[model samples]
Target chain A: MAKSHEETADPSIYVPSQDEDMLKKQKKKEWKETLVGYAIISPWLLGFFLLILGPILASLYLSFTDYDLLSTPNWVGFDNYINILTSDPRFVQSLTVTLIFVFISTPLKLIFALGLAMLFNTGRKATGFFTTIYYIPSIIGGSVAIAVVWRQLFGRNGAINDILNSLGLSGLNWIGNPDTALSVLIILIVWQFGSPMIIFLAGLRQIPGELYEAASVDGANKVQTFIKITLPMLTPVIFFNLIMQTIGGFMIFTQAYLITQGGPMDSTLFYALYLYEMAFEYLRMGYASALAWILLVIIALITIIIFKTSSKWVFYESEGGR
Target chain B: MKKQNSKISDVIYYTFVAAFGFVMIYPILWMIMSSLKPEVEIFGNAASLVPGEFRWDNFSRGWEGFGGIGFDVYFRNSIIVTTLVVLGTVASASIVAYGFARINFKFKALLFGCLMATVMLPVQITLIPQYILFHNFGWVNTFYPLIVPAFLGGQPFFIFLLIQFIRGIPRELDEAATIDGCNKFGIFYKIILPLLKPALVTVVIFSFMWTWDDFLAPLIYLNNAGLHTVTLGLRNFMDADAGTNWGALLAMSSLSLLPQFILFAFFQKYLVEGIATTGIK
Candidate 1:
């Protein structure tokens, strides 16, 4: 209905004349193409503005006010931010736990992925058999079922301790101890390094065989060839994995939520779990909003840092990057 | 001597991978084995791989689920939600991908940039406000909150992947269709849709996997036990107090992973390829 006005008054825009017939046709085609393009993508367009963009901005606004979802938002500018940044112990605890998890687990997970990928890439015809077996965990790892199993595996008199005691080696209740709880979560994470391993395998394949052959011809050993040829070539993939896993590491929830419940004095209270508790459990939506904003800032900063520093270490084969 | 040494290294490689693979899947094996163990035997001989007697009734007992609701209801709920989610994601993502890959509209690049940025943005940033918005819509504690977003291009990763796939398709097909008097939409329907099958499969498998295993959305929305998905149902097993039915929990937990195992068995090639493509480039 709105376009009716534009259609009726379109003569001024493109006059139909003898000399300008082709040009008019071109203009009309362009207009139709644009219309079709928007029509095709309208779902995403509407979704973005409605679901994602609106909510992101609203959350930002809500972060500055006190809204408990039951009443109208009370404007208390920066109180959430002040208390979170200044004096809140749990906030500090969560931040510390998250940073520790991310910093420690990301590298270990990537390394494990890379090591296994290299092992798988060792020119064996039967390696596909191994990858299939190993990738099962990454598929089902995020489920509550697996998390439940993990809790049992590390329970006080669970299988781990039973096996340890049988071997005359006492094992601590890994999931029940503050000192070892985060390690349990880290192990869970590192164990599911299957997807990244596949990524590394793909990256390894793309490293030209000629490079390895040349290094071998030049009398380079395995470690030397890896360092001189493989590592630098794989840096771009490494950088990608780092950014992704770092983001994912910070968002660790299901494992910690189910396995330890952030227990043993909040030793494993991931940023996400805490934020969830604040919002839904405690009904401090405004403070949680602030915490969520702080998380976004932290993630954005870390991403930017990685990208900025990438120029120093990440080696793209050519400027025309893959 | 040199050949013998190389053969020994081969032996070492095979041994290491085999041993380590066992270590990797040990917990899962422990779980499946424990599912067959009696509750007393599950803990009493927890270190042992074999149970003295198999308690096959655990599966039946676990199938009864907590409260009055059975695992059948949970499975049905998950199947319904995941099916709709997968369909919506594939349909919407393919449509959007076609627009971006084939059409040259003004602001296309800008919108594409926004899509990529959304791919990088954390879900937590929008978690609260989306919850609030859904609450305003009176959609809380409903499957609508879990399934609606899929129809609306909520998953940028799928859109991004499909765009990459659609671009790889030769434009000559579209041009030929255009020459034959096929309109843009006709070309998309006739040419692009059929050709985009592989990418669509990738989309289907991933969307199915994620939605079926999705905990947060279901946790936030489906508070009623009658509507609990398998993941939530399994979580309730853990909530069953000190006299926990370890046998039932293990059995149900193992059962919860059946679909994933089936998918992995049948589509490991596609799954591996999807991971490779999505993870690296």
Candidate 2:
């Protein structure tokens, strides 16, 4: 191994001219590296073809066929797509519910995360402890058990209502009511904003201390310093969080499934949750496939829009990229 | 004048932050407390945060049996599945990430871009077909479906994360190694792998948590009770639609969360580093 290291070093890195023996050794090393690289990447390559790409294309094909678990798919081109778009009321409801969730939850989560990150950045002692406490909810928030606990806490006679009664207030049946069930899911999303908060904290750290000092020396008040210095500097991180949280929010399912089970007149029926119901309960494999494709297009469009708009506001540290 | 206002603001801030913290944690704390309280105490004084009696038996009972099936079996299954998935995700994701990060190849950007697209595709999109594919292979009711994909670089998000981390390592190290006659493979193993410990640990922790917490995959795949993971086992503890043996269920949930919480608490620095490294850049 060390011998190749000695052999391949160009006396002049930019110059290509070299000895024959050294050239031959470099070729041999290149061959070895290629072999190793292939070996290392084979896991992804194998997964790409077998698990990911295969299922994706298969789903596309499955979308045009009437297939159930019991039997082979019979080709039915355009029917699945047509049915979902024109005929399926459930599909429309699911899409509406999903869009509402994405719009509400993503913004709320971002605001919560940004606010917490700002507070923590104010040089508090035991910052790690507070951050960890906030993050623990995120770590376990999506678990089925947590969802069950959510259900219990929000149920008609649950702890939340119990507290309201103690305060001499009339208790509303939260989970049982359609209007409030969606709010519960949104609240769940917001509570788990800790991951983004931590990321924002890291982003905050990256804004040089010197900049704040300079702003302070310039006699800028704290609010001005924050607005002028911190917000602009944190925009990139915020944008990153926005993209990720949007994608994540658009795929919300577990809370819907475990907590409300898409109940109270389908108010909490998340897109993914509804898709699961279609695929499993109704055995609408083809229709579900079509729904999945539509979701993919929606996500792709959102991501593309983000990238397209990024140049206007995103402050890249480097100018190297064309 | 400004200092005094700021102090008042600080007090307001602390109050707001602490109150929100309490609300966020109240359910979790309530769950833990309820797990110790017997069934009668649960509804009798539901608003109370503390249990009247510490039912150590709740843990023992939850550990032993619920609905004629012992949690021991489910616990074993969870451990086995989570451990394997973590090991598999770390090994595969790191290797694949190294390949993407370090190795120059034909169509490299295209392939990496394709992998990125995979990250945006909803997992539910592939759920039906993947189940069909696995079912055809007789993988249902087995750990094969749950555990095997991790070894095959299952989670693209983790791979993307590791790829970013591996990119931050100086390419000069690879060049330096090459000058000393160390091949690309040698550079990856000897030079890059050590540098990726924090990222790899992050992948491991995420894989473990995801697999352990996952309900949909296990719900669809595992038909047998004995083969259930904790997520499935906990769901089964529910009587029909309603969850029974509230104390035991809460106890089991709390117990299930202990492993991940303990791991995170111990290695939090790595988690923080990993989150920053992956997301900030």
Candidate 3:
């Protein structure tokens, strides 16, 4: 490679009239390098257009039309959207259930994660082992097998109910009851708090020790330091975890699908599960596309709202203040 | 007095940690023990941690899965899909990351921004149209739907991760390579690729775990029992209408977790580091 470059850069072979030729060659080389760059990135660029960009635009168009899989799409304009807002009872219920799942599970999971993180942050000897143990749930939490296990665990004669029975209480069919089905799913969601716990642990580590030392010296108690120092310092990480967990909470399908199948009264009919049913099972592809768009809009709106409000509470130690 | 107070706190802290650790790992322990018990003994020994008898036949029975298919076939299918996905993800993501990290091409910032935006875009948004597209291409019920998009850089998260990693590499090395008459590809091949082992390992481990555990994509595409991944096969075992074989199901479930458990044991440092870095970014 070095020899070839030296041969190309040889000065003795060049004359004053060949300067334009050399300049042209340089321009060509530059263009060739640019093309090479594009060539290298073309896989992602092609996927972006075909899979992401094209699908997004197609979904937008499909949202306006009434296209089932077999038949040609008939243009229905905003009728699907309007009906979803006005008359579709299942849609309304799914939206409510999804919102409730997101609202309930996100905060609870965060709190559980934050609590564990704080406890572990005290520098225990077995912290590594404990962290690994906690993280196992989040790894397999979304698997079908785990969901099946969770189903059995909350079944009529399952382990949880067995424990309940042994404690001088009657066992309730937790997964079978419409009222408790969603709660059971929420418990599963909260149980997988290991990811956020890790993030919060990292955040806790980032908090300067001098702040705590100074607070202790000034006679502040643990609660005061937590509220006034640790919490404020960790707000950015909390904000990140909140957004990610909320988005994940909204898109939850497998657990609902595997455990309840949107069960006893459609009590656990999550948004993504409903969309899957509409598209694949019902073959209402167009309406499902519309539902997909609505989910996107809801996520976007929630994200925007969070970002808009983040300035109030999300402190950055580097920025000093917003 | 301070040391005495701290000692008491330490005792309380360890106790709390131990209790919570037990709660965290109880389900896994229960699953393992239940898998060893007889079908009737599962519910009977539900509240107990130990099995009365070690019925090892649960593994063999579960290995002989429902409807002429077996757990061996499912595991084979999963391995095939996951291996291809890991290869495709690492190759495509590294090249894409090199482009964004090293090259100053036209529309670079805009394209990078779009890539970032897609990371936040829910998979549900793209589900239907992609499904239709694949259906039109006669790729339904095949591994094509699961594997091809990966080769085309479908996962923006991995690309972005590699971009961060490649960006951290020194620009001086590229300039030096360029002065030595090495082309852009040469610079990448000679320098950046060799230096990207850590991030590439992170990507490989994540891609393996995600692909192994993925349920929805296979559920959507692979309708045939023969092509079913492990997740789909496990779901078939829990057919809501049919009476579930709890022993076999739990046995297979435990088996499904073995690969992940082993991977975690070996690569715990990289896994935790990957998650931490991703979160901070």
TM-scores for the candidates? 0.96, 0.90, 0.95
Clashes of 2: 5
Q: Which stretches of candidate 1 lie over 4 Å from their true place?
A: A1-16, A320-322, B241-243
In model 2, which regions exceed 4 Å deviation? A1-35, A209-223, A317-322, B1-13, B170-187, B239-243
DockQ of 1: 0.72
TM-score of chain B of each: 0.97, 0.92, 0.96
Point out where model 3 deviates above 4 Å. A1-30, B240-244
Instruction: Score each candidate by Cα lDDT.
Output: 0.89, 0.83, 0.89
Best-to-worst DockQ order: 1, 3, 2
Model 3 chain B: worst 10 consecutive residues (lDDT sum): B236-245
Superposition TM-score, candidate 2 onto the true structure: 0.90
- Order by lDDT, highest first: 1, 3, 2
- Model 2 RMSD to the real structure? 5.5
Tens-digit lDDT track of model 2 for A214-256: 9989999989998888887887898899898888877777778
How do the residues B187-250 of candidate 3 rate in per-residue lDDT, one tens digit apiece?
Answer: 8899999999999989998888889999999999998999999998989887831345898889
Q: Considering only N, C-alpha and C atoms within 3 Å, which residue pairs clash in candidate 2?
A: A4-B181, A5-B179, A5-B180, A5-B181, A6-B180
Which pairs of residues collide in candidate 3? none
Docking class of 1: medium
TM-score of chain A of 1: 0.92
DockQ of every predicted complex = 0.72, 0.52, 0.61
Each candidate: how many clashes?
A: 0, 5, 0
